[model samples]
Target chain A: MSLDDLYQSIILDHNRRPRNQGPLEGADREVHGHNPLCGDQVTIRLKMDGTTITDVRFEGSGCAISRASASMMTSAVKGRTTAQALTLFDNFHELVTGAPPAGTKLDGNAGTPGMSNASGESTDVKMPRELAAFAGVARFPLRVKCASMAWHALREALVG
Target chain B: MHRSDFPLLAASPGLHYLDSAATTQKPAVVLDAMREFYETSNANPHRGAYELSGRATDRYQAARERVARFFGLGDPDCLIFTRGTTEALNLVAQAWGRRELEPRDEVVITAMDHHANFVPWQQIAIATGARLRICELTPDGRLDMDHMRELIGPRTRVVAFPHVSNALGTVNPVADIVALARDAGALTVCDGAQAAPHMPVHFDTLGVDLYAFSGHKICGPMGIGGLLGRRTVLESLPPWQHGGDMIQVVQDEFSSWNVLPHKFEAGTPNVADAVGLAAAVEYVDGIGLDTILAHERHLLALATDRLAAMDGLTIYGPPAAERSGVLSFTMADVHPHDLATILDADGVCIRAGHHCAQPLMRRLHVPATARASFYLYNDESDVDALMRGLQRAAALFAVAGSASD
Candidate 1:
């Protein structure tokens, strides 16, 4: 419940200078996500090469949690294949919602056997350490939406 | 007076509640009255021939009379008991707007109106192919009287506006707006959701065709509100809802409606909550609306001066003399949600969002604002807590800024 738990140094840094921000050119997939309760909005655009996500970017206005989550998500998913990105998304979603990283070790350890994506390949991917900074958001139930806004948009863009 | 009346406030001793515009905490007397109703006269009103039903009917009728007197409505029957201001306004839009409005007719509303007043008219206009005209606000966020004078014309069938802007706290010129609507041969529906809590509302004196106010905003229970309309106007509009209580005769193919207020109230009305609202009315009257208004004005003035002194802070709405107890503001670097969360850490509760007035937020060019609205229970100490909360949030963001450098 402490503010420090939710607004860690990493979150504030990402929010202050968000990485991979603004619009992407010739994006093959684009999606918008909004949390109507607090008016947090994010538009995610992706440039895909076959199943690989070559580049990703986001643009919008929101609270520190939302902006920082989007920045970390773009940095995590860049240069990864679509299936790996989806797996990372699943791991990140679990991390923020108070669930342990189920099938993957995101703390700089080797990956475990994970679920497979649409390509029938093992979706076990390395969880980026930076994305784990948002685990504290699970304590503040209302802010889970702020932390997951970008991931929801990324899910829609990739799966849909 | 120090939070003893409301159990929630009593439990959370250090909580600085500034979201009165959303809903006011109920007093002990209102709660007791509702409990008393259940203990003594709990029965379906106006149905059974038993003594308990008669007593229930009597209490319900008495609550209606008390509400009518509180709002200065001459005829208690002209007032309809609604779920809240939203339902009351919707009843007007459906019953009156649908029947009277035709294609090409205009329903003029201001940009300062809450969505409760704005959306219903917009939908009615769209449904009837009527033109919905939006009057602009002045630079200071007051309803632009000059713009209203121009927009209201012969074709303007209705003019619905809020007595106070929930987002900006601007106390609009109700008399002027009503005069214009009257001149154009149009009906005026005044949204009194915010106004009735902070100030005394004399519905008949306002010269409005219809006025709506919620119970929860004025220390009453939720799910109960009052809507006052002219007796002739009430008779003219058909009932928006029809069921057991609102009918006079039920035929095989056709049914006749009941008289004035009952015609609009369908099914089993919220009688216990109505009694609670009556008790709330008495509680506020005991405090004297003028005294409450003055106390709130003092708190608002102090908060406004303190907030104005802070750097990178912009306060919306008119100046202190012209506005109500609500204070909406935004800091330079902190989003309202972040600010509100930081404030909550200090037990300072303030609203942070569009205030259900998205159009007003767009007009002000802010994604959202943090609003601190005061009521009778608030004092100078509450304002001090708010100031401290703002400073803490600002300092946190300032540290974040320097860390990035």
Candidate 2:
């Protein structure tokens, strides 16, 4: 695909004007990620209400891919149940890593189109579905690590 | 360097190839040897009673002997084939480091060592609980010999440093460093990855405990390299890997490993690539090392002179720095990646970023650098293309930065 497809307008918008930024101190969990390839660094924070994610924010120094991904992730998962949020993480990870569940079409929205909404309603968030834009990103091998750095660091925080 | 000998030189759209420090282009002779091997005696080495195996084994052993003679060693027994410099260093880490290392015993390493040399020691140190002490580098990328002298005391058991820095391209005085390391009673390991490709290397002259160099970097085939250590050193280290070929006898309760080279080499090795490497080394030998070193020095002097003249440029290393072809530099405000991208657009292949030397990169106080390395194959035209590429990078990045603003 072209740069236009990879750096879609929405991704660029998130990169240019990130949604949740700066430090979130007193956060239940905080994680920092670094991509040595392009020298991208990010610090993500999860402010939780008991076991649920009450708020999520991040601050980092990185390229467009990492910054946009972090912003999108925090916005998508804030106020999510820890377990529910983890499922979203697993799904998004599969799309980026090319290990999608069997019988799932390669199309971006073929399986489980969007993340669950807070009202217990399901809205088809295009940003979450746009993750397949990174499926091609994974094929490069080196860039796969760059795309996955944020989620990997998040997992480290929750687990460790 | 003559372009007629190399077809890639004729095919690449333009010049400014500074990545030979990573890997050099194959000479006409090296290519011919590979072709001759495949066309004539392509067979598994040390396996069957056939003319092909005999010829193949002859070619493979000749390469080992060639390496032994090239390093002025007494026997080919000292030369062990490995994947590359990384594995060679790691072999010592596994074989020697595993046996001798004890808790609280230390491996004295230099900060300037390439990660290949650094990480293996780090891992082995972690596994053995042998502490790791690093000798720092001067701002000019020279090993702080004083620091090495101090750090490598009686407690220090191993000392590792590159004979030449792959990133800064500063050539170290191995003989001098080895003397100090030896005085401290630590076995010295020198990384010859950048050294062997550019200049003549004689391990006997350096007198280090172990010296490792890769074939691919010297226009040889990939997957073939040499680990030159004294036979006694080899004897002391345990066989860290195991399987067929490396063994002598196997019983229900006990097994014995093979001798010297085969003990280290546990399986069917890269027969073809080993033959190809033998050829590559022979090609270098026929050219005469004096001619090769002179050609590289002449090209390096010219290229570094051209780069030193650029405006707003910051070249890392001393003026008249004891350098090989690898030259790392930075330009005002233009990131190395941006510079590399612009140069790539003009078909100039150069290495950007940390060169896998993160600590050294941090020492330079920059995110990364644009590196232009030279090889014997590169000529004035290639260096000129690099100069033009840098100029293009400066202008285009300047324009792009302003336009983005």
Question: Which digits, one per residue and each the tens of the lDDT, describe model 1 over residues B244-315?
Answer: 899999999999999989999999989999999999999999898999889988999999999999999999
Of candidate 2 chain B, the 10-residue stretch with the lowest lDDT total is B396-405
Best by TM-score: 1
For residues B265-384, write the lDDT of model 2, one tens digit per residue. Answer: 988877777777877777777777778777777777787788888888998865433788777888875557546655665677888777878777767777678888877677777777
All predictions: root-mean-square deviation over Cα? 2.4, 4.9
Let me know the TM-score candidate 1 reaches against the reference structure.
0.97
Checking candidate 1 for backbone clashes, the offending pairs are none
lDDT of 2 by residue, A24-120 (tens): 8788888888877756677878877865778888887554556667788787777766555655666677767767545422233323556444555
Q: Give the C-alpha miss distance for residue A100 in model 2, angstroms.
A: 10
The regions of model 1 sitting more than 4 angstroms off are: A99-111
Q: For each prediction, how big is the interface RMSD?
A: 0.9, 5.1
The DockQ scores of all candidates, in the order shown, are: 0.75, 0.14
Displacement of the residue B332 alpha carbon in candidate 2, Å: 3.8
